[model samples]
Target: MTELPAGLHEFLSKAGWEGAEIDPIPGDASFRRYFRVRRPSGERAMLMHAPPPHEDPAPFLLVAQWLSNHGLRAPEILAQNPREGWVLTEDFGNDRMRDWLDENPDGEESAYAGAIDALVELHRQEPGPFSPYDMPTYLRETSLLTEWYAPAVGLDVDVSGYDAAWSEALEPMLARQKPGVTVLRDYHAENIMLLGDPRMGAPQGLIDFQDALVGHPAYDLVSLLQDARRDVSEDLERAMLSRYAGRAGANEHFEADYARLGAQRNAKIVGIFTRLYKRDGKPRYLDMIPRVWAAMERDLAHPALGPVADWFARNIPDDLRKSGGGTIK
Candidate 1:
């Protein structure tokens, strides 16, 4: 095994884990890294290494406490050194929703329902200390499409016109939303954990929520139903939407807001995925673009997205619409 970083090793030793076995865990797209540590007593804990100057652990700590305070299931912080960006947290094991679904496809419905149930519980809580997902944030996020993806595909879009069009399309949609709630910006399959049994009332384990925001209640729901990585079936998506609407007493404009936010989110993701390939040198994300575009297309079909649809018609070309390696060039 590779020697741990000096600071990390000292931190662990000082924390009474002097002889624990440190096993590196696979990471995702972010700069964060994780390790599984087995103590002498055979107890396990997760070590999160968010290298400073690139990533910070403060938000994760804050959100975890906030979630726990609200009776939600975020990792318990066993030990932390915020300045060093090291946090030893509760390990939820390997039963991620995606892996579970792969092993038991039939359980998709119940798993999604449990996820929705969690979201319902979260939205019911008071808002967190994050910025509202308002007009400026929306426009800034959508600009990723024009700023990154457009250039990647060799489309030189007029920035001023693009911004104007998006502002016009999204302003009214923002006005239609009810007061904002706590929005887990990346609430999807891969980040959800099935800890213990749901029948016993153990809430689904949540992670990667440092980007949580005070946004429309529909935003997280859209993220869950219209996942960029996995294909959530239309029937399941509809059922969950109805379930949330019934439970939350969502207003008449909820459906429109959901589609509006869905389109906005997918647009941001398309640009992000393209940027990941061109700038970050990660080509695997390119494979997910087709699915993101399909989700975008579905959201654009809503009447509220007419202006955004027109903007896309004027910007993105026909040949670039499909999936596979051929679509991105």
Candidate 2:
């Protein structure tokens, strides 16, 4: 058996999970690790190990509490040692929406509808206590494409023009975000677990939202529909977007906001994925850049993105953009 981390036994014992069978679970692109803790009495819980200096469990705990209090299905915290970065929470099981959709392709529409409904429900709640996803944050995230991906691909991008274009194009979107709602920054299929019915408005188990922010309602909607890890068909995307707009009483600018956020988010992902591969030695992430690039391309076509789109056309050549700058290495 693989050895456990320092203080693991003490923490589990204190939590009454002594002698449990702990097994590793696949992790994401962060410095956190998860374990399935099966107690001798047959209870199951999840253990999150977020080492200090690189990760913290405080934000996750806070967001989880906020989500649960708001009628969402975020996991319940059974025990915690935040200073040491260990948390024991109720198990959410393995039926991730992404994997479930892969197995039962016929249920895609219903699953997406449920996901959309969940977002609508979340948007109905009062904003959480979090920092705003303001212009500086958005601009910093988008700059990753120029900072990392451009350098990797041997492209000399016009950084000033890029920033200027995004600023002009994103103003309207940001304006709508005033008195923002709680935006689950990484609200995508992979982060959602289908715990109940897959029909419309069904409950989903939310996770990986430690980075949640107060932002525009359209941000999370775009995150879900324009997923980077898997393919979301254009028809489904359109249907879901319409469903959200209708249910949430979205105005005429919602589509434009969605497109702007999508472009910004996709650009950020392309850079983050590239950084993961080049700097962190996780080459697998590079495979997803092409999909994100395609989504970004579509988002840039929107008139709301005219300025930013022009910047891309002038700086990033067609061939370079097509390859997503991932084929460099």
Candidate 3:
């Protein structure tokens, strides 16, 4: 029997779940860990362990309450020990949107449509209190590609030049954002859940949203449509975009914003995936880099990305673009 961490054991005991069955749940890229707890009465709950100095539970608690208060289906907090970085939240079950799409391939359209509807509804809400995803944030995120990924591919370019080019390319787009909406930085299939009933009002349940920010509405939309882990079919992507545009009353520059954000996001992911391998020793993320690069190429084709596209061409040779230990094409 794996002994529970001292703090976790104490927290469970204090929460009146002393004899509960605690089973470790699969983890994500972050430092946090999760476990499923089953009480003697057959009730289930989720225990989140985000060890301090690395991960904090306060942001999760704040965002979860804000989301729940706004009528969204974020998990309810049952108990908490912020100082020790522990949280007991209502169990949302194991029906992740990614698993649902895999199990029912033909249901992509409906699943994505439901997600789009939820996004539209979320955008309708008044902006919440969150950090703004401004030019500095955008630039810092994109720098990961050059900082970590460039060296991985054997190209040591000037970091200053790279930053300058991105600033030139991304500044105008960031400035034009219209009174930003609440942007869930990771709003893809893996972070979403399907509630499966219209009576529940919001058919989607949200998770992994502690990193929410106030940014362009197009940011989250692009995150869903151009997902790094899953292949969002082109047809479905277009359909969902149109759905969001109509429902959100998007302006003429929506397409430009979407494409630019997508390009910026993919660039950041490419760097992040590489760093995950080099710094964290998680090499599996490298396999996903090729797909991410392909997506970035698609986004960079947009005219607004000329400066960024040119930078990529000049710095990273075509053959060195792919990162997953695969042969450079």
Number of colliding residue pairs in model 1: 0
Which 10 residues in a row give candidate 1 its minimum summed lDDT?
A: 320-329
Which residues of candidate 2, in runs, are more than 4 Å off? 200-202, 324-326
Q: Cα-based RMSD of the predictions, in order?
A: 1.9, 1.4, 2.3
TM-score of each predicted structure versus truth: 0.95, 0.97, 0.94
Candidate 1 stretches with Cα past 4 Å from truth are 1-3, 176-178, 197-202, 322-326
lDDT for residue 61 in candidate 3, whole number 0-100: 93
What TM-score number comes out for model 2? Answer: 0.97
Best by lDDT: 2
lDDT for model 3 comes to 0.84
Which residue pairs come into collision in candidate 2? none
Instruction: Give each model's clash number.
Output: 0, 0, 0
Residue-level error in angstroms, candidate 1, position 239: 0.9
User: Best by TM-score, which number?
Assistant: 2
Instruction: Report the lDDT of model 3 for residue 133.
Output: 90
Off by over 4 Å in 3: 1-3, 197-202, 322-329
